[model samples]
Target: MTQNCFDDGDEDDVPEWADRVMADVAREVRRRRKEMKWSAQDLADRCEAIGFPIPRNVIANMESGRRAVLPLVEVMVLAEALYTHPIRLIYPVGYVEEVQQLPLTYPVDTAQAMSWFAGLNEDFRADHRMLRHHVAHRTAVERAFFAVHSEERQRRAAESTVDDIEQAKALRTQADLAERTARAKAELYQVRSDIYADGDPLPDLPDELVDVDPPEGYERDTD
Candidate 1:
């Protein structure tokens, strides 16, 4: 179905991939312009001179989705204008159910079409093996990407597990140190209490005590 523009009613029926595919196309087009350092007006003027006559706002709206579902021929023309491969603009990320409707020819040039069809047939038959090889190569690339991503995720999980173990060890060490501190403080308090008892030799010091003594060399060495 050729939709000039998508309406609100058709919003639900628009495949979830529509927005993403449109956005990707727009982004690539924009990126091409940026890479060439061309302003929107510059591109528009060039296209106009070449008989395409695209306006800056038209390009902007298309990219911004105010205009949606650009025709494939227009996309190819844009690719030519941008000096990029048409396939780059049309390559689908995942499964894309796309249909291109070509205008019907009346009083058709059967000879030309037949010639083109013959060439296509020859190409298919001649390059079938090479085409299969490329397809296998693409599948391998996709599988490798998946495997790399999976390995990265597994590595992160392993690192997280190690971190958790380290944190637990640190916590255990802290608890042990705290317990030792409390015990030492309690023992010192007991010593102070004993000193302050009626039959004890000296007065007890405060529970929170700071032992202050001169340097060890303060006392003469007894031989």
Candidate 2:
């Protein structure tokens, strides 16, 4: 006889806190899936595609709280299918605050950390994107300059002379500067991302948190 995937056999052993968390996770999963206009079957198919293999009925059970045990793997796959981070599903605002005083382990969870970052206020998110754009631009410039520098170095080496050595040295210095600049920009963005994601208090913003278009000629290159 085949056992039910939803029946983990320890349903009665789940704590009230865990039950509440699962309920919240269920609501979030259902909400996000609906927001994406995906049916439960669609979600199940997606989970299966990602190798988690949750059945449609299992998803329904999860969303309806008929299933008490929600594995982390399933939550992750579901979150991916719903185009969100697992933290959103597992650690909604209320849940986080409720568990804040407890010795919960979510604070150290990387996925939760990323979800928190992704859920930061508009201003921080905007600033992060801008910093990311700057980093990308600098990195692209560095790569292009490095390629040219490599070619120049090879050509100069073939000539077997030190005539252009100073110029090559200057180019190398510029490349190093560009790399440092990119690293600094990336570090700044990461710091902000981590701070906001960790729910630390942020200072007042210089401006309102409205969404602004990327600066001219420096559009975000997510790729």
Q: Which portions of model 1 miss their true places by more than 4 Å?
A: 1-14, 92-223
Deviating ranges (above 4 Å) for candidate 2: 1-14, 94-223
> Please, what is the whole-model Cα lDDT of each candidate in the order they appear?
0.52, 0.59
**What would the TM-score be for candidate 2 when compared with the true structure?**
0.43
TM-scores across all candidates?
A: 0.36, 0.43
**Local error of candidate 2 at 83, Å?**
1.6
Q: Which lDDT tens digits does candidate 1 get at residues 37-156?
A: 998887787777767778898888877778767777667777888886655554422222332212221112333333343444556646664443444434433443444445455545
The alpha-carbon deviation from the true structure for residue 6 of candidate 2, after best TM-score superposition, in angstroms, is 28
Model 2 C-alpha lDDT versus the unseen true structure: 0.59
Judge candidate 2 at residue 212 and give its lDDT: 17
lDDT of 2 by residue, 50-133 (tens): 887899999999989899698988888888888878777766654334331122232233343444556554566566755544
